[model samples]
Target: MSVIREGKVKRVLEDPESSQHVIIEFTNFVTAGDGAKKEELEGKGRLACDITEFLLQYLSDKGIETHYVETLEGPKIRCFRAAILPVEVVCRNVAAGSFCRRYGIDRGIELSEPLVEFFLKDDKLGDPLITEEAVMRLQLVNRSDIGFMKSIALSVNHYLSELFAQQNLRLVDFKLEFGRTADGRLVVADEISGDTMRIWNKEGESLDKDLFREDSGDLLSAYVGLLDILRKTDPKIIPIRSEEVHVMVMPKEGIKNPPGEVTRKGLIRLGFQDVKEVRVGKEFKIVLTRPLTSSLLKGLELMNIKLLTNPIAETHEVRLS
Candidate 1:
């Protein structure tokens, strides 16, 4: 593995097996106070990794593509290669924290529209939140990109708000990042950990940032307790695919128009053995003799299926006879 870059909590490395990307090793140190102060909080890194993985999986299921791939080791997360944007996208639906301190807004007051803010990723300057004009003046990103990012960030916050509400928690605010892949597609990047979010309990008690601010001296313990509650309340399991495999041939365009036998033959020529005729918009099932491989995944990508949705499987199981 070749070292690409090292940050406070993660290190990027070039994987020799694939030229297309690198992996990120998540670290154990937690930093606050604009990176001026650092503390080795026990289990902080693992907690972050777990929370991030959960959020990434949830978002991906809702048609959002994130940089997360999988966990490599105990607390390390592997991610695809990308050029990271140097701005933190903050989306808030309610007034809290800096929003209240800076603008004299009442905490917990809902806004008519979601507020999207951008902050430069400079720790020395205390990561001051700035306006889009300031971002353009500094040449951080183009105007069009900023507009697109704001739209996407608002969409993300809406999605997350609904999701957490399902879990009986209020998502006060959160930060997001974006990265451009090698193919020039911009996707949501970075970890969505507890540190980057403000989670509130049913009683409107702070479950996240209050640990750091209240001087309670048991921040890590409080975080772990919250994790335990989450695990017990909303455990997730990946469903096992049935022994019978289902394969469907979806046309690139209209489903109402039926393809001729020659088109079916072409599908057979394209390595789709046992192609069967079926009614439009109906599913067909086929049993597979082997599990899917990386090559097959690449073929699916070439067919544009990967770009249409997240390609990473939530869980993979193999069968051999």
Candidate 2:
């Protein structure tokens, strides 16, 4: 077994049967603070592997070059061989963690724009921050390579952000690593999942590797939750009905959460007395292919009940618009 690199969370094994392929195995171990903190959680490996596998395929289908080939037995994957880079690309959307402590910025203060940073992937050096110019000057990666990595990093950021947002999760930040194939073709390497991302749900619940780092509750469960949400809500899932019809589910009567008196008064004070009340409700628009058969209509009704609206308080109407 040509096991080249074994990290705390994953290991790379060269496949004896395939020269151009390697087996990346996810381990149960979770590490943080440059490996200062560590623990082995049962089922962590499988959850991480599941999410990484889905995301690799997701990004690949979106035209991002990745080393992932296919999922193997259990928590393992067959991936293309690449000369791994020693730099970690960090992308941030909302301020948190080290960024807040180092820059004295308040937590959750959204950046005017997403910030991209580079760091050396050295535990001994504590993954010290590195400048793009330094990356080229030190001959680690040339300017062109740096630019390519940045572009890929930003692209992944965009896609992943949308991916999580679909499930009502905010991707605060993530770490990505890139590598070069034997022919020097740049491709995204390593795994992505809760371990590499800072995720927050619609209700602002922390649901990623931060649980382990911050001593939060049920680290493994959080990892599983992340994978579960992604798998259930991923557009790749079959029940998507994407190629067929457009089902718009709107409530027959809006929810009774109208604007407060102050809001109404403020609107009136602004010379908008014409607007007396504002009741807000949700409308779900799902696009699927045509030919909405009886069976499909039943499924849509089931969906409308299960995921769209509350039958007791709100009723929904599904229309092919």
What local distance difference test score does each model get? 0.67, 0.78
Which candidate ranks first by TM-score, i.e. highest? 2
Q: Where in model 1 is the C-alpha error above 4 Å? A: 228-321
| lDDT tens digits by residue: candidate 1, 87-120 | 9899887788888989987889888888899998
Backbone clashes for every candidate come to: 0, 6
State the weakest 10-residue window (summed lDDT) of model 1: 312-321
Cα RMSD (Å) per model? 13.8, 16.5
Write candidate 2's Cα lDDT for 172-246 as tens digits.
999999877775567888999889889997676689888888887788888777878887665553221232233
Model 1 TM-score is: 0.67
Return the top candidate by lDDT: 2
**How many Å off is the CA of 77 in candidate 1?**
1.5
| Deviating ranges (above 4 Å) for candidate 2 | 234-321
